[model samples]
Target: MSKRVASSTDDVASSKKAKIQDDDDDDSAYLEEHKIVVEGGDARPIRDFGAFNEKARHQLEAAFAAPTPTQAISWALALRGSDVISIAKTGSGKTLGFLLPAFHKMEQKTVRGACSPQVLVLAPTRELATQIGVEAAKFAPAFAVRTATVFGGAPKWEQNHQLKILGGRGCVVGTPGRVNDFLDSNKIQFSLLETLVLDEADRMLDMGFEPQIRSIVAKISRPTQTLLYSATWDNKVQKVAATLLRNPVKFVLGDAGTKLVANKDIAQTVEVLDESKKTARAVEFVAAREAAKLIVFVATKRGCDALCRDLRRTTKCDALHGDKDQHERNRVIDKFRKSKKGVLVATDVAARGLDINDVTHVLCYDFPKGTHGVEDYIHRIGRTGRAGNKGRSHVFVTPQDSNLPALVRILQDADQPVPDDLKQLAFTRRSGGRGRGYSRGRGGSSSYGFRGRGSSSYYGSRPTGRFSSSSSSSSSGTKIRF
Candidate 1:
C-alpha cells in the first residue's frame, strides 16, 4: 500500500519526455501496414508462430486460425527477447498477443514439472484477468503448462489453493490489489519472473493502481521483459513506461479498421439537452435508434441508476455498475447479449473487459473524462461494430462540457470527423458569445436547433434538441435523430 511518488528531478523529467518522443516515433512507424503484416495479409498469419518453440508453435496452430496484428507483434518481439508496449484497438486479440509469449517463456523454463510461473500478467479488472486465464488455458495443456488467476470478488482461499498447486508451473493472472496481496503474503514469488504484461495499462493507472503496480514491479528482478498494453498511450502511461520499460519497442495499430476516426462505424452523434430534459432526451434518442443491443455509459453510479430507472419506466433498459453483485453483472451482460434491442446502463467499469459481442449501438449518456475515459468511450463504442460487423455510437454532450472541443480536435487529428456545430461552438467560445447553432439539413434551418424542444430554459444550463449523427458503415438504416 506504499505510494511511490514520482520525483521531479530535472534529469528524470527530461529523460521521461525523451522516452515519450521515442515511443511516439516507434509507434508511428509500427502503425504502418508494412510493419504490421506477418505473411502478406491485413491480419497476421499463423506461420510466424512456427519460429518459436515447437510446442508453442503447435498450440498457436491448433488454437488460433490466424494471428491477430497485436498477437503477431507480441510473438515476434517476445521471441527476440525485446520488450514491447502494444497500443491497439479493442477486440484486436491483445490477450493472445502476450499470452503466446508467456507460454513460450514458461516452456523454456519448466523442467520435469518443477515449473514456477516465469511470467505475470496484470489486468485492471478481474474479468479481463479471468479472460486472459481462460485463453491461456486453451494453450497451456499443449505444453503441459498450468495457470492460476487471483482477483477480488472471489474467495482468496480458493485462489491461494490454486496458486499453491500451480506454483511456478504456469502463469499467474490477476488484478493489482489481489496480486499485491498475494505478493505481500509471500504466497507468490517473483524470483523467476521473466516477463511482466500489464493489460489495459491505461485503466490500471487511471484507477490509481500506480502505487500497487510500482510496488509489484519493484519486487520483480531486473533484466525482465515488461509489456505495457492499452487501447491508447497517454502521458500517464508514457511516464510509467519510461520508469518500467527499457527502450521498449512500441507498436501502435492505427485507428484504421476502428470505427472511431470516421465516427461512422459506431454512430458518433450528440444530443444537447438541459438538465431537466436530459432523461427525456436520452429516452427519445434510444427509442428512435431502436438498436438491436445497446450499452449506455454514464459518468457516475447515480447517473447509471437514475438513467436505468427512467429507461425501464419509459423504455426497456437495465443497469450495471461497480456496486452490482457479480451475479447481477453477469446476468445483465448475458441478457444484453441475448436480447435484441436490449439496453444496459453502466459505468466505466463495464466499459472495458466485458466481451458482449453483437452490440449494435453505444450511448454515452455523459461526457467521459481523461484519456482513459476517452479510451473507455472507444471501448464502449467498440462493443458494437466488432468482428468486421457494422455498429453505431451516440455521445450526449451539453454546453457544460466545454472540453468536448479538445476531444473533437484529438479525434480529428486521428482522422475522425467533428460535427459542424461543435466547430461553431468552439468558434463562439473564442469570440465570447453563443454562436449560431447549426441545423441538420438544408439552408441551416433552426428547426434542429438546441432550443424549445423538451425544455427551452435549459439552453446554457442544459442541452435541448437533436445533433448530427453520421454513418461510415455501408449500412443503409444508419440515421441521426434531431
Candidate 2:
C-alpha cells in the first residue's frame, strides 16, 4: 500500500511539470506575435523576433540590436518552397536576411543523413564564402546547427571532414566552383536540401561561374526555396532568376516608381584632366586627409604595381590585384584594415570581395574600359560609403575622342552636374537619349550611351581606341577606409 502511494505521487508531479511547460510555451507564442513588428529607418530599435525561439532570439538580438533595410521584411516567412529575389546595395545586411530564415527552416526539419546540406549558399569568391561562414558560426551555437565552408584555397579534405563528420546535415557556404567539385565527388547530399541562396548573383556571372552554378542547381531534385540577391541586374541576372525562381516577388527599395540606382549618400564627381597631371592630383587628394583611408582603382596589373610603387615613396600604400596569391592579398587587406590612414592601390579584383569599414573615399585613377558600364562604375564607388556611411566617389576622365562623350552622357544620367571641362569635350546632344531620358524604366538604362569601343565620334574628331595618359607614376586608382 505504501509503494502504490509513492508511485501515484511521482505521476502527479510529472503531470504538473508538463502542464507548466505548456503554459510557458503558450506565453512565448503570445509575446512573439506582438514583438515582430519594426518601424522604418534607423529611428528605433527592432523588437525581439517573435518567430525565433528563446535561444535564437537572444543570440540574434545580441549580435544585431537594430534592423537593417533587409531585415525590415520578414524573409523567414517566405521559406515555404517559394522563390525570393532581393536586390539591395552592398553592406545592406543581406547576409542575415536569408541566413536567419534558412536557419529557422533548418531547425524545423530533421536531416535524413549527413549526405545533404540543409542549406547551400554560393558566393563568387572565397573571401565572401568565408565571410558568410563566419556569420553562420555566430548563430549555429544558439540553434545547435552545424555549418561548413568550402572554397578553392582551403583544404578540400578538411572541408570534406567538416561536412561529413563535424557537420550533421548543416549549412554549407562555398564558391560555385568548389561546391560543384564536391557535388561531383558525391561528398555532399542534396536529397533533403531545404534552401539555396545565391549572394552577389551578378558578380558570380561576371566571374564566369554561370556553368558551375547552373550545373549545381540542376542537380538538386529536392523542393528547395531559392533566394537570389544581386546588387545590379542585367540580361544574365534576369536569365538566372527566371530559370530558378518560381513567380517571385520583385521589390525595389525607394519611392514607389524609382528603379535601383547608386546609393544617394555618396557624393559623386568626375574630373576632366590630362593624363600627365593624374599622379599630381592623386597625391593632392591623399594629402587632403593625411589620415584618410582611401582606395584607388586602376585598369591594369602593370598600372596597379606602378602606382603602388610611386605612392609608397611619399605615402604608405600597398598594391592589390589578382596576381597576388590569397595569403599576400589577405595580409595587405588586413594591414590596410588596421591602418588609420591606409591606402590600397588595386585593380578590379578589389571591387567585389573587399569589404572594409569606414572607407572615406574611392578614387578612379584610370577610366574604366568600354565593356564596363555604369554598373561597374557603381560597384567601384560602392567600395566606400558602405552601410550608410557618407563617402566621396570621384572618377577621372581624360579628354579623348573615345570616352569623352560617354562620360558626358553617364554624368548627366547620374543627375550630377557636368563640369565645364567635360561639357567642352562633349558634342551637341545627339543619338539615343533624346526623349527617353536617363530613366529608361526598370533596366536602369541610361539614354546617354557610353559604348567605349568603336564608336563614330559625334564630337570633334579625336583619336579613339583606349588611351590613358598616365604620368611617370603609372598608378591608376586607389581607395582608403579608416
Candidate 3:
C-alpha cells in the first residue's frame, strides 16, 4: 500500500511539470509577438486602450494610433499599482507612460487640498521639467487635474501661487533642487503623495540629485507607487532602485547596459575628417538640405556660440548653452520648435531631455567627452528620429576621440557601414602611437594643432559614393575643399 501511494504522488508531480512547461511556452510566444521583455514578474501588454476611463482613452486615441511598446507594457503594470522600472530609448513617449497611470490613481483616490499633490514627477533639468509641464497641460484639463511646475530658473512667487490654486490636489513636476526648496519652505508637502515618478532617472542620478530625491521620498512617510524611466541602466541605477522600490516589475525595451544602444530609427554616418574641416562640412550639409530642421552639438558654450554665428550667416541659426539665462533658453527652444526649418547649436545640456519634433538631421561638431561618450552620442542622435519619424546623424571623427572601438561597435549593431579610415584610426591608436588631442579656439577658428607621426596618414581620402559633397556644392554653388 505504501508503494502504491508513492507511485500516485509521482504521477501527479509529472502532470504539474507538464502544465508549467506549457504555460512558459505561451508566455514566451506572447512576449515575442509584442516585442517586449519583462522581468521580476509576468506583466502583459495591453492591445486595446478601451478599458481606460473615457477621458484617458479619448486622449490616447486622439494623440496616437496605438500604444508604443513601453506604453503598452507600462500602462498595465502601473495601473495595477505595481512599482515599475522602464528602460527604453528617449522619445519613446515615456512622459505619457507614467503620467496616465498617475492620473488614474489620483482619480480613484480621494482628493486632497492645497500644497498636497497626489503625484510628483522629478526631472533632472529645467528644460525637461518645463516640457513635462507642457505635456501635463494637455491631459490635466480632461482629468480635472491641476498641475504646478516649479524649477530654479522660474520665479518662486509665481510657482508658489500656482501651487496654492485649486487646492493643489493634483500633479507636481519639478527639478529636485527646486522641489526640495519648496518642501523646506513648507510651501509643498508630500504626506498625501500616492504616485512618485522619476523621469530620466539616470540623468538625475548623474547630476547628483540622489540626496534630494531621498529627502523628498522620506517626507511621504508611507508606501506609494514609484516608477523610474531611463534611457540607460547600470549599477548606480540598480542601487537607487533597490533602496526605493519594493517588488517592482522591470521592463527593458531593448538591451540594458551602461551605454545606450544605438537607435535604429536614425541612419548614422561617421566621417573621419580633420578638425579644421568640420565647420565647412556642417555648412555644406545644411545648405544641401536647406529646409531640414537641424540640431548641431558642440562641446563648449563658447564653441556653440561661435558655430551659431557661422551658420547664421547662411540661414536661420540660434545658440543655446549653460551661459544663457532661463528666459533666453526658453525663447531659443520655442523659436526652433516653431520654425519650418532652422539650426540650433547647443552643448550637452540639450542632449538628454529636450524634445522638438520634425528634426531631420543632427550634426555632431564636437563629440561628447568623458567615460559616458557612447551614452551621450546616442542621446544627441536621438534628438532626431522622434515620434517614429526617420532621421539622419552625421558624426565627424578625429584621432583625438578615445571611444573609437566602442563607436565601431555601435555602427556594427545598427548595420551601418564602417569607414575604412575609421578602422585604421582605431587600430593605430590602440597599438600605442597616441595622437596629440585637438582643441577648438573660442572663435571656432581653424587653427587647431596636432602632433604625432600618424596624425594625418591613417585616414584615407574621403569616400565619394554616397557621402560626396558634389550635390551639396552644386546646389549652393560653393565648393568645399577637403
Candidate 4:
C-alpha cells in the first residue's frame, strides 16, 4: 500500500470543520474508522464530562478538540472515583485517559486547599514517565499543577530538589524505585494520594518491579482510585487487578484487550529465512528498499549492538537498548525523530512507550517471545502507520523458531494479510516436528487448535508472497525499492 500524505491546507481545514459539525449528531462518524468493536456489548464513544472543573475541561479541549475513546471512557469512569483498568492500543490517547481524571481530582482538592497533589502515576520507563509528566502539565495547567519526574541515571540530588519543590503540592510521576525511595525518606507522603495510576503495568511486571509496585501501593491509603493501563492484559494484569482494585470498571479499547492488533493502515509482510541468514537478509532488505526512518527490533541488547555495528558499516544506524545511559538514549531518540533517513536498532525497551511517529518502516529482526512480547511487536510496528497514514512492517522468520505459526495466526485473526510463504512455513514446522502435538492443516477451518506447541493460542485461521531488489538515490539518502 502506498503511503498517504496529508492533504493540502485548505482540504485539512474543510475536513476539520466537517468533523466538528458532526460532533453533535454522532461523533462516531469521525471515529468509526478507528473504532474496534467487540461482542457481548457495544462500546459507546466516551461521554463528555459536564460536571468537571472548568479548568480541567479547558485543558482536555485544548489537547484534543474532542476526547479520544480511551480518554472519554476514563474521564467518565475515573472522575466518578471508580477503579479502572484501561486496555488500549498505543498512540490511542491512553495517557490522557488517566491524566484527565487525575487532573480533575487535583483541581477539586485545590478548591479546598492550595493544590496538594493527591495523585501518583507509575510508568515503566523514564522516557514514558517524562512523557506522562508533559501530558499531565497540559491537562491541569490551571491549578498551579506541577509534575515531578523521578527516574534513575539522573543525579539523585537534582531529583530530590524537584521533590522538595513539589512539597506535596503537585503530582508525583516516577519509576517504581524512585517513588519508593521518596516514600521511604518521607519526602513524599503516599497516604495523601487519592489516585494511583500504573501505566504500562505489564511491562513493569516483566521488569520485576512487582515488589516495588506492591510496596508503593501499600503505602497509599485505601479508597484511592486505582487505574491500571496497558496495551495488553494477560494473566499478570488480571491477578494484579484482583488484588488491587475493588469492583473495577474494565475498559478494553481495541479488540477485547488481547494482543494489540497490527495497525490496519500498515501493510505487513513476512520473509522466511534461516536463523544464520536473518541479519544478512535484513541488511539486504534495508539496503534494497532505501527505507527512511527505520526501526529494527532485536530480542537482546547484545543483538541490538551487533546489528547496529553491522548496519553502520554499510549504512548510518544507531542502537538503543537498556544498556545505554538514559541521557544518551533520549538523545538518540530525538535525533532519530528529526533525521530524514536513519535507522534505530532496539530491544523491547524502545518498543513500549517511545513515540517516534514518523518511522516509515518497522523490521522485526527477531520474532517476539511470548504474548507480552506480542504487545511489544505491535508497539514496534505501530511506530509507523499512525494517524490514518500507511506504513509497512516486515517480519523475518526462521524455520527453527516454532513460534511463527502462532504469530501468523494472531495476525490473520486480526484481519491482517499473512503471506503465502509464512503459511507454507507453518505447515512445514507443524508436520516436521517429532510428534510434538502438531496437526495437519485443515482446509477452510477458521479455528485450529495449536495450543501449548508454542507460547500462545492459534486463533481462527488459515491464511494465504515474492521479492525484488532495486535502488535509487535521493538528496536525503539512497533509496532502495524491493
Candidate 5:
C-alpha cells in the first residue's frame, strides 16, 4: 500500500557484506548426509521443545508430531541475524519455524504501542494465511496472547474489529493483498513489530507480491527480525534473501521424509498428447486408479471447470481455483478430502498451501508454462508422495510448451533419464511458426512406470510409439487419429 520501503539500520546494512563464509561447506544433493551450518556458523542440532515457555511447549507438540529439521534449524540459529532465510520441503512443518520464534519474542515485550503489532506473518494465499492463523489460535491460548488473521474472501468487518477495535496484538497472519489493503488505509501499523516472516516466499514472488511485501516491511519502526521460507532457492528467492536479511543464516534441508534431495519418493512420468485427446487420456488415468485420490492440475479456471464437469459423468469430481468463492473452495476441498477417493481439477493455486495428504496421483492436465516452470512442477507433484508415503505424477505435454527445454535440463541434472521423445522436443526450435507433432510410440498405451514398483524414473523410458488412451488400463495399445 505504502510506496515507502522498510528502513534499514545503516550499521546492519554496512556489515551485511562481510558475512561469515561457509568454509567446511560439505553441501551434498544426495547420499552423504551433512548437518546444517549458517554463514560459517557451526552445524547445529535440534534442541528439545521441553525448555520452551510452558504454553509454547503444549502448542508445539499439539501442532506437529515433532519439530521438523527445518523448524529445528530455524530455532537453532534464530539469533544469527536480524533475518533468517530457511528453505525446506513443503509439508515438513515450516509454519512453526517462524511462529514459535515470533511468539517467544512477543513474550518479552512490556509495552504495547498504538496501532503497532509485535509481529507480522505474511503469506501468499488466503488458505495459507488462514492455516497459519489456525495454528496460531491453537498455540496462543496457552500464552493468553491474541492472534488475528486478515485475508480476502471473508468479512473484512470481523478482521477490522480484531485489529482496530480489539487492538491487534501478539501475532497477525495474513495474505499480502489484504494486509496491503489495511496498511494502505492507515488502519494498521508495524511500529512495534519486532519480527517479520515471509512464508512460502517463492509463491509470493511468483504471484507478483514483491512490491507489496517490500512496502510492508520497509515501514517497520526498527531493524525487525525477519524469517523467509520457501521450498526452492530460485534466483528471485536468493535476491530477496540478500536484500531483506542482514547477515542471515541459510538452512537447506532436502525433502523431509526421505532426508534425500526433494521429490525422491514420487515417481514422475509424462505423456505428450494432442490437445483434443488430452481429456480422454486424463480420464483413462483416473479411472485406472479407481478409488485413489487424484488431483488434476489445469492451466486456467475455465479449464478446471470444464474438465471437472467432463470427469463428473464418470465419477464424482470437483474443481478449485481463484474464481471460486472461499466458501465453495473450502467445501470442494473438504468434500474431495473426505471422500477417500475423488478427483479435483484446479489451477496452480492449489499447488501450494492446499495440503491434502494421501493424494495418490498428481496429473498435469495442462503442463506448466512461463514463470511457472519446473519449480512449480515440483510443488504440484509435491502435494502427493508426502510424509514418507509413495505417490505417482503424470504430466501431459504438448508442442505449445516453451518450457520443454528447461524441463529437459532439470530432469538431466536430477539424474532422471530424459524421455527419448522429449529430448527431440527440447532440442528443436519452432520452424516457420509450425511445430512437429508428437512422435508415435510403437506398442503400449502411455501409462507411466507400470513396469514395476518403487521406480524413480521420471519419464519411464518414453512411449515407444504413439498410442491412444483406452477405457481399460491393461489395453495393449490404444490408438488415436490426429
Candidate 6:
C-alpha cells in the first residue's frame, strides 16, 4: 500500500541499461524465426534444456505439447541462475517460464527451516496469484514441490496453516500486500529463498504495490535469483528492473516500445455507436454466438452486475468484479471455465493475468477510459485469442470517449480495419470540431451486426450498413438477432 519507490542500489542503478544480445548465440536461427529479442547477458536460446528430471519432464511435455517461445528463452537464462526480465504478451505461458526454473532450483537446494519459503511469486491480483498457484500445483506433485497461495479476501488462518505445512521448501505465490503482511507477522521467512518471480510486474506497479514489493525484497538477506515477467516494457518497468534485478537479461517479444498493443491472434472489430444502444447490441451479439464462451468487459462494478443480469436472461452467465468476495469470484471463474458456452461479465479486475482457454469471444460492452485506458483495452480484448487459438473481440465506441485516437492506433497496429466512424471520432478531437452524432436504430443497417461464419466482413463497410448476422436459431425456434 506504500506509494514510495523501491530503494535502488547506487552501483546497480548506474548500470541499469541492460546489455543487448539477441542473435549472438548458436540458436540465433531459432530466436530469429520466433522473433525473440534477448537483452542483458550472454545466455542463448535453449530449444530443450533437458534440465527437468524424467518425471517432471514427462508431465510438462504432456501438459504442453511443446515448449512455447516464452518458455524456451526463459528456461535458458533462469536455469543458469541469471536475473532475467522477460516481456511477452498475455497467454504466452509466462507462469511456467519462471515457475519451472524455480522448481529446478528447488531440486538442487534445501530450505532453511520451518515457515521459510524457497521460492516466492508475487502477483498484483488474487485471481492471478491463485492462477499461478494452480499452474504450480500441476507440476508440484511430480517434482515433490509443495506450493501455497496467499492473498487478501482469503482467510489468514487458512493461509497460515498452508505456510506451516509448506515449511522450508516449496513455492509461495501471493499478492504483494498479503505477502508483505505474512513477512511482517513472522508467518513466513525468506531465509531459504533461492528464487523470486515477479509475474505481471507492470500490473503490480500500476496497482501501486511498489513499496510492498521493495519491502519484501529488502527483507531478503541473500542475493536471490530474481526473474521479472511482464506484458509490455516501459520506463517504469525498466526502472523497477534495475532496482531489483542484478544485471538482468531482458528477453522481449514484439516491439519493446512503450506503446501497448493487442495480440495478433485476436481479430478485433471496433464500432462507434451511441451509449444507449450498447446493452441491446451486446445482448444481440451474445445471443448470436450462443455456442461460444464469451467474456463481456464493462467499466464499472455496477455495470458488470447489470450486464451479467441481462446476459443471464438469454444464456447461463456470471459476473466478476472487485466488489465480489474472493470466494464468489472464484466460483464464477470456475463455473465459467467449466461451461461450454457461458458468459462472464466483468470489469478491469479480470483484465490481466487470468488465463482461461476456450474463451472464444470478448465484448467490450463499456470501452476503457482514463490514463490506463489503452492498457485496459488491450488486456480486455486479450482475454480471448489465447494459446495460439484464434478469437474475436468487438468494442463499442461512443462519441464521449476521448481515447479514440489511441484506440485507432491499436486497431491499425493489429492489422485490423478501422471503421470510418472511428476515424471521424478521432479526427473530431484532433481538428477541434464539435462531435457529429453517431447513428442508432432498430434493424441490421441501424446497428453493427455480429458476423457469423461465411460472412464477407465483420464490421461491414461503415457503421450504418447491412452487417452479416447468423441465421442459427435457438432450440425454441426463435431467430437469433445481432
Comparison by TM-score, 3 against 5, better one: 3
lDDT of 1 by residue, 1-482 (tens): 22343444665889999998896666445546423522211222233567566766776677556666577677777667777877777767777778776776676656432324677899999767766777778778766677898899887888888777774456899999999999888888876778899998977888899999999998886468888887666789889988998867776666522223332345465554333445666666677666457788887775677667766755788888888876687677767766877788888777776665577778777767664445556677777766446676777655444556555765575455566655655565667754335343566442223444554222122334323222121211112452
The C-alpha lDDT values of all candidates are: 0.67, 0.68, 0.78, 0.68, 0.68, 0.78
Number of the top-ranking candidate, with TM-score as the measure: 6
Instruction: Specify the poorest-scoring 10-residue window by lDDT in model 3.
Output: 457-466
Between prediction 2 and prediction 4, which has the larger TM-score?
4
Error of 3 at 457 (Å): 20
Roughly what TM-score does model 6 have, to 2 decimal places? 0.85
RMSD of each: 13.0, 10.9, 8.1, 12.2, 12.0, 12.0
Count of steric clashes across candidates, in order: 17, 14, 0, 5, 10, 1
Considering lDDT, which of the candidate structures 1 and 2 is the better prediction for this target?
Answer: 2
1 against 2, candidate with superior TM-score: 2
Over 58-139, each residue of candidate 3 has an lDDT whose tens digit, in order, gives 8778877887777878888999889999988887878888998788777775665768888899999988888888889788
Candidate 6 C-alpha error for residue 463, in Å: 25
Predicted structure 4: lDDT? 0.68
Evaluate residue 14 in candidate 5 and report its C-alpha lDDT on the 0 to 100 scale: 56
- In model 5, the worst 10-residue window by lDDT is 455-464
For residues 221-262, what per-residue lDDT tens digits would candidate 6 score against the true structure?
A: 988999998887878888999999898988887753446878
The stretch of ten residues in a row with the least summed lDDT in candidate 2 is: 36-45
Candidate 5's displacement at residue 104, Å, is 2.9
Cα error, residue 385 of model 3, in Å, equals 1.7
Whichever of 3 and 4 has more TM-score, that candidate is 3
